[model samples]
Target chain A: MRAPALIVENLRLKLCADRGDTTLLSDVSFEIQSGEIFGLVGESGSGKTLTALAIMRLLPPTIKATGKVIFDGVDLLALPEYQMRSLRGNRIGMVFQEPVAALNPTFTIGTQLICAVRAHHKLSGHKARERAIELLDMVGIPEPRSRLGFYPHQFSGGMCQRVMIAMALAGDARLLLADEPTTSLDVTTQDEIVRLLERLSKDHGISVLFISHDLGLVARLCHRIAVAYAGELVEVGHTDALLQTPLHPYTRGLVRCVPDLTQIGVLRGGIPGTPPMPGHWPGGCRFQQRCPLAGNGCDDAQVTSSLADRTVRCWKSAASVDTASIENTTSPTNGPKNLARNTTS
Target chain B: MAAASVSSIWSVVLHRLMAVIPTVLFGTILIFGLVQIIPGGAAEEAAGPEASAEAIAVLREEMGLNRPLHVQYLSWLGNAIRGDLGRSLTDRRNIAKAITERLPLTIELTVIALILSLLIGIPLGVLSAINRHNRIDAAVTSVSGLGLALPEFWLAMLAVNLFALKLGWFPATGVPSVELGWHEHIQSLVLPSLTLASGAAAAITRFTRSGMLEALSSSYIRTAWALGLSPAQIFFRFALKNALIPLVTVIGIITSSLFGGAVLVESVFVIPGLGTMLVTAVLQKDYPTVQSVALVLTVVFVMISLVVDIGCAVLDPRTRR
Candidate 1:
């Protein structure tokens, strides 16, 4: 088995406000194998980004996190901030959603990239700059040396994302936390960025925790996928297996939401209800309000139930297989249900 | 790349300099126009109230008050452009010479006050922002509020009483001669300059605190943190630099306004700076000197703003374009 690059166990986040503490994320646990791309898919406000921030120990002062984030057998959560600094960017690099905003506007790409290189490497400015240029070229930034002095505003969204990726890899980071790295780009650029990330992960043997709201896009890149609903992971399995026969109701709903160009005149209604606000989730299953398979047993939730090769949180996972008629009555609509249906045969 | 940026900087400076011309013109005209509307007759004030009507008329003619307003303005502007501000109507002393003698002292006081405010304000602001909503933030915020509210003259007097009289840590009045040595000169100016700085420092603290708070919350600062930069590096290299763009405007405003505040402080301390000279000129109805000093102060204010714009362009590359 490939060595585990990062493992998070029972991660919980709470916002300690004057009113009271609001539980933001509870019991978020996942593992990423070396060189594997693990997708954490969820809607906005579902705490996917929060998970990444928690891992990095970058949450705001008011928000508190308690959990073990073991990286390379060392518990990151237990480490002092000074030790964490040594590991962050050097071992665990991050790429934010907004590429333009992620970079300091006052500095040039060369300066920013060189700073990252020097942070952990203890290199001279010239050496750091050379390495920065090398990294830019590796990320497909043309004429890297010439573009070094260009500011973030001078670069396009796609180029900025590429620069951000290069900077993330500047310290030879073993694991990359990419928080919707391509969310701001167009479809064509998003595909290019996905391909680049996939290639980089394969070549460098770097593990990546890719967080995104789009299942289709995540499926194109991630090796394993975890579905988050209201700050809790409801399902985790191989990407194709999860997409084809999603065990959790929330995962199935997400799979069904992916756009299908083959199905004409079929209007896809997105997940019916908005995700519950933090501190307002139902006592049992957080997704119960929107789950089509929600039933009596769902009132009392169970921790993830391990099936043959998947972990699903839903109480109705076993009954869901026999309830084929219920799934059909909801109207398949526009979906890559074709892809899953094709896989079924 | 250096050559290109240098040329671009020059172009920006050129463009800014072009913009300043109109502002300077407007400022000069406004000063000249406003002095014209003052209630007292400069000739009568200069000749004395008992002077005969003929003598008053002769003085008015000599002073060019009988000339067309525009003609008078143009001649004054022409003389100003040539650095000849004309003699004071009251004492017949050369206004330009008087200003030349006093300008450096005023500039020194204002500069010291500005430097003091920046050194005090920026660090306190950063500290306040970093400890936002905590006791330190509250203390700094409330003290700055008091600084902003208290009148400058009252603060000056209080400072003089405490430091000069009670504590005997500083002199109460008059700047030291250069022969007294640089340290003594600086020391003697401390009370007046500190009093002048109090309000500006308070304003700057507020602006810098808010600017830094916003900058600290920015995604870039988060990126800096993620990049494993030390807290000091993240604060000074990233957050403070980002905050400085907006802070520059507030500083520019404070620097310009300090010249005005210096007028009162200089009078209280008897520093013999431009402010004191301006006060003397105004009290004696020395119109040429008053007009010249106003013009000089306005020009200084305009120049400070221009420098601020250029500084912003340097700090934020996007503004360079």
Candidate 2:
């Protein structure tokens, strides 16, 4: 396996408000290997984006992050702000959700790209312009030299996303924190962006922490998948293993919810109930309220236990060696009633 | 590409310039109609109460008031377009020549006042917005609030009383001719321009503060911060440019109002300006001079608004659409 490029250990984030402090993320630990695209899959408000922000130390003033985000053997949480600023675009780049809004409307694309290029490198203005054109071409923009003078409004949404990608890559960063980069794009553009990111990772050996709400897309792009429920990662494993037999009930619900092509004309199903809001999460297991196979044991504190190929955070999965039987009992045919009966007996 | 954009800007300028014709035409009719509705006829007013009926008839014929109202308006408009505003009834001086001399004074006063407003207001607003909700912000906000509430005429009178009458620092009346030297000329402008600028400065301060606050929270600003740009670059280059877009319109409105306020300000100071000329012309029933002055003021207002549109387009390309 490649060396871990980013290691986040026990990253806890809390929102300090006039009312009280609300824990937004708690005890979130994960490691991204070099050149790997690790998918962070969850519904909205599940702290997926917050995790990325916390790692980058970009949380707003009221939010407090306390944990060790170790990169290159140094704890980033303890780094001085000036040092962090230097590391931001030079070593780690970020791409935002809204492509068009992410660019300054008044500045030409060339000026913006040249600014990004000259930020980290000591290049002359002419050289920077050439580099910017090359970077635009690298991102597959047609007629890069001519399009440099165009403003953000002149470009379509997909083209704007490509420009945003080019700016992110202009810094020659090793790790990219992409937070729902394709969420605002159409399906065809989404596919193209996904493929572009895949090729970038393959060519440049850049590690990506791809955060999204679409399970099917994440499974398709990510080498490994971590499913977060509420504010905690409920299960994490290889993409194929997690897709085949999701050990945590929340992960299973996510996998089952992916829209199927053969099931056209049938109303696609979604996991019942919404994720709990920050500061209101139930004690013990956060997902017990929504889990189909939740039993009396789930009311106790959930523990992350390592299995042969993955880690499961459910008490039922940790206690049983026969995960296949547990999975079979929780199938749609058996449903929650049968699983609850089996757990009691 | 540069040529294309330049040509497009010229086309926009031409279109805007064309739109001004109907506005000016309407303004002329309105000015002519308004002076026509006054209590006494201009011919009788010009001839005086003791004048005989023959004298009034001769005056009416000479001034073209004996013709129908439309014929009188049309003839006046024709002469006005040819740069001849006719002779003033009271003094018999050429109205256009009188205007050329006085209009410069009013334009200078308004320009100085506008510059003072922008210089004083923009920095204070940026400071307040940067330190938002703090002691400094509250202090600036309250002070500008006080400035806005004070009437310009009262302020002008008070300034004249204190600075001119009591302090003996400035002369209260009569602008010095340029031949008197720049020092005395600028000294003469001090009290009147300050009074005219106070309210507009306050208004600009409020608008700039709100606009800067809105721009500071925009998504592009967040992206700039994430890009690791310096604080100076972020605030000055990114935030200020966006903030200036909305402030341009506010500045335009303040400029037009400054011209309006100059009338009161000029009267209080007894300065030789278009405003003073307008007030005297109205009182003496000088309809030719009144129509020309009012038309000039309207055209100025329309042109200022046109500049505001082009300024916004230049600052924000999205508005160009």
Query: Over the stretch B1-321, how does candidate 2's per-residue lDDT look in tens digits?
Result: 556556667676777789989988998889889988877887887898899999999988987788998998998999988999888878889989998999999999999999999999998998899889899999999999988999999999999999999999999899999898999999999899999999999998898899889988887777776777777777878888889998999999999999999999999999999999999988777777888899889989999988988787778777654
Q: Lowest summed-lDDT stretch of 10 residues in model 2 chain B?
A: B1-10
Report how far off residue A319 is in candidate 2 (Å).
Answer: 2.4
Model 2 stretches with alpha carbons more than 4 Å out: A321-333, A336-345
Task: Score chain B of candidate 2 by TM-score.
Answer: 0.96
Q: Which has the greatest DockQ?
A: 1
Docking class of 1: high
**DockQ of each model vs. true complex:** 0.80, 0.62
lDDT of 1 at B288: 84
What is the DockQ score, from 0 to 1, of model 1?
A: 0.80
What lDDT tens digits, residue by residue, belong to model 2 across residues A234-256?
A: 88888998898777878877776
Q: Candidate 2: what lDDT? A: 0.87
Candidate 1 segments whose C-alpha is farther than 4 A from its true place: A319-345
